[model samples]
Target: MKLAVLIHGLLAITPAAAFAGYSLDVRLDRSDGFYKVGDETVCTATLMNDGKPAVGEKLRCTVKRERDILRRDEFLCEGKAVTVRASMDRPGWLFFGFEIIGPDGNPLQGEGIFKHRMKTTIVGEIGAMYDADKITALDSRPADFDAYWASCRCKLDQVPLDPKLTEIDVPRALRGKVKCYSIEVRCQGRTPVTGYLAVPVKARPQSLPACVDYLSMVWQDASRTVPAEMASKGVLALYVSWHGLPTGKTADEYKTIAQTWYEEGGKAGDTDRDTWFGHDMYLRVMRALDFIKSRPEWNRKELVVRGGSLGGIQSIAAAALDPDVTLAIVSVPSGCEYNGYKQGRDAAALYRGKEAVARIEADPRRAVTLAYHDGVNLAPRIKCDIYVCTGFSDELCTPSSVFAFYNALPATTKKFMSTNPRTGHYGTTKNTAGDKRLSDIFRSVTVYD
Candidate 1:
């Protein structure tokens, strides 16, 4: 057996990143479309080089099973066509992709997907198969896990939530009928929580539901931090930035500040719970929840939280820590099954990295401290509704690890878990079944009037 690896999911080679002299664009006849198991799945690609067929160019296709390449083939990029034919022996995920050496000698690649359905799910596990309901987390609940978080929550409660809101003049792209605000709230940490708050100018803010888009692993942009459509859906929406910086900065200013913060924060936090790089982000989220609950315009029973990847981790953590959260929508969530590597499987970047491996090896206390942030360790404590979209072949956040988190939920918890075929490290949208479930979850909560 041979091992193949790519530090995928953080980012992959896309056509947009192609060499400037010759750029590539890929399109499928259809994507995230339907298919039946055992049906001949003929995958094809149009390799356009600067809007023309990439004639005489060498193109390669690699099909994957999880992180492993199941097969590889090469052909000339002629007639604007390249094809890879494959079929799921049974209902499961399949991936088809293309790569070519750019004029600069760097590889540029693109991908397309089709989900094979069996009327029900097949191949429920990604790496190291197990019963979805039976998979257990390797980290047992720390004896003080409940007590520690309880103390933190109580400490947070004792802190006075001095909140401030100011109307912001955003670019037209982010401005309109909705009134947007720059919001600030003092949490348990030295830094205050910050984000953009949006409310429908025509609707009574109190009359609508409330939603928080926690944010993704990618550092957020100060401009357009909040989704403009959030207000149209009958909700007062707040988009929180983990950086806790004021919104509305020039692009260069934002980038410089973010780079500085990452350098300062990532290098300094490794000693304890208080110093961990993520402690402030999570604590501030809880404080932000407190602020949301305090608003008279917010429906007390309709607070919904949503995120993907790292944001998904925060959303789950927030729901577990706060019983006031009503619904959580998470996608390809990281921070799950951190110790799955113990079983010859891989873990998400958040949990299983060179730094983490070193910490565990250097001192046992580091691992103990990290368990406090593990999403799987927090899953059983969640009591609200959860809708998660996970890829059957997400190498970044392994499906098996996500199942471990899902399986441990309280038996009474209302939850839905859906998968996309070979949809590695991406989000679910309305076009996919998992995304439809999320839409329905929110739809049920929106008031018609």
Candidate 2:
């Protein structure tokens, strides 16, 4: 997605020390303002400290629903000023306004209306078999796959790792046996990407396996913590971020540009710029691998990449394009069968351009472009072993898509594990059981005598 720049001039406020005051600003950075039934929309509001920057201990932004489209009945927001935190939920638009309540009992309000739309394809009550069959046909041909990825390759020379373009530093607060570092990898474009890297202090030479995780909507940052349990297992972990994250103050802060990247039609000659969604992320993952392989302490040959949701999607893509990736563990990944998935759905509702979807569907070329980034397409191309885990209740990523990718795996050593979780889009209570099984499987396949 193209990054959005907030054009509102800064509002500077000065207040007398004896008096207390507050101000609220409501502006839509970029809003088409219309949505279909099932689409997800993000609206951002910036609240400025207009009064004596209070000595308050707490601040909050509450989104209250005014209209109930898509039956979105909740409000979710995470993080404070200057940090981009997010409230994770299924796809839908927010219909409420935001209010900030200060510690001293002062309330500032910002109000706006937004809508969410559903893509056209999945709108009706069609059976799963029809949807599955349509997707299978669209995704089946290898030729279609080749055409989609034709332009996605970055010449080995184009991979951005110049010391001049990127910077690496270890935070003093993180300095210790913990072994953590902050990395800023500059994309050729205007936006600079940043992420965190951590490794176990105690790891055997060849056993220092590394795992690179691609974050979802959240940006990569120091505050982001990986489960200590994973690190304790002697695996080096890196979190690569997209959007304004790892840098932006709020997930909503990055929504403008994020939406642009997935805009309706192919802008100019760009058939599928969204392909870079995985390409750029995978590039950063590989760069993290480069950093780990450079360390005398790590085992360069034992590298694994895993993620759930968006990260899961990247894991599969990276494994497909980069032969060095030894193992991939993916869960509930999005962006599998675009055309098939978007059919019958309102274009705006699907977070895509109506004209764009129509154009892509009419022309086989667009499907060709999608093939390069499709995890299902890449799954069969991965040379290494794969462990796939999917939740039966996942809504964002249908169980059918996960099974499609799993069945496509060309690796003879691949394994499949399904969890019938009552929850949607998350691993089961047996996640630990699944992890142990994966670790054992990796040891069996990759460990040398």
Candidate 3:
């Protein structure tokens, strides 16, 4: 399939102002930055001072195969743009990143040039993907992948699913129109599935379609209290938090928990599949689906799952693990093609290359356990209509890995993929149009009006 046209038009100059009236603009020979294997991709890097070409400026440039460095050199901006050419023999990405350096071999200092806290000093980048659709998971699907997940389902079945619902205040406009509550459901894990549920106050039994919204990885409290405005259109909306921690907790409480998670990290229990952190995460996903289906107000005809980044990962799991899910919308999803780094592509799991490989090599069980959770392996069983949005510029969940997941989906599954070349991860840039498109799809699936 050809790259989305909407993505080609999204590329533009960097939005931030450069320091000391200096700016760097990077561009690819082809705006979309897609190429066939063995095709050379050229990146033009230009430096400007007060909107004019900064002649005689020195640029330190590096070409990388994902995170692996390939070449590093210096170029002179002699009243024109300097070019760097790179290519990949296999399906993957080649990133050409450059920064302005002074004659003293030190990076130029200015207002936006140095961000101490972020540890990111690079000024500009051009990312290119070669034969992206041809990329696949480095590791084969374990033979027991199905049997393992089936056992997880059976284990979750034994849990009581004792749901607790507490009425909560809604925005003034929704006071009479919508009934909102804080909901918790017991599952097989140490924590319960917790989130906010919004239902139309006047809906009759089996009247409204259901939507389960997954939040992106959250470390602090945010306004996850309300559903999209469309929830009032006769949709039963459940906003599930990834961490089963209480909703609306004091800031300090959340801070303490986040610190603990940060230090322990997501890979804490990966050695054994049964105790792997992902095991409990999937359990919560299955239980959340159960809780939504249990609602008397559910129409029993339509169920939608939607999220971005980490939430996207869970959304994929939800649809794959449950046959009831009719639609899934995900963007910039991580946790895909977990072992891709072994093939020189970036790993989309919680850890990076060497560390991730070491864990798998150290224990045969880890390899099997990770395959069970890899999105590429799970994509084939989704069987639901899917809408995926990705950013070619995203490093956390690289475009190559996202494409691998998309390619793994069954040919008969109704699906669409859209992208923005300028957006990265989540906050680096926003895809307003793509977001609206996804919202429209969600509304179509659940909106009663």
Q: Which of the predicted structures, 2 or 3, would earn the higher TM-score when compared with the native? A: 3
Q: How many backbone collisions does model 3 have? A: 0
Residue 405 local lDDT, model 1: 80
In candidate 2, how many Å is residue 121 off? 22
TM-score against native, each model: 0.72, 0.56, 0.88
Better of 1 and 3 by lDDT: 3
- lDDT tens string, model 3, 28-47? 77787788998988788777
* lDDT string, candidate 2, 184-266, tens digits: 65454323446666655555466666677767534334233662234444566666674323442465555554566533322
Would you list the C-alpha lDDT of every candidate in the order shown?
0.62, 0.45, 0.75
Tens digits of per-residue lDDT, candidate 1, 260-344, equal: 6765435246458777777777798798788878876786768888777877888888889999888887777887766665654
From the highest lDDT down, the ranking of the candidates is: 3, 1, 2
* Weakest lDDT window of 10 consecutive positions for candidate 1: 118-127
User: Local error of candidate 1 at 85, Å?
Assistant: 12
Worst 10 residues of 3 by lDDT: 112-121
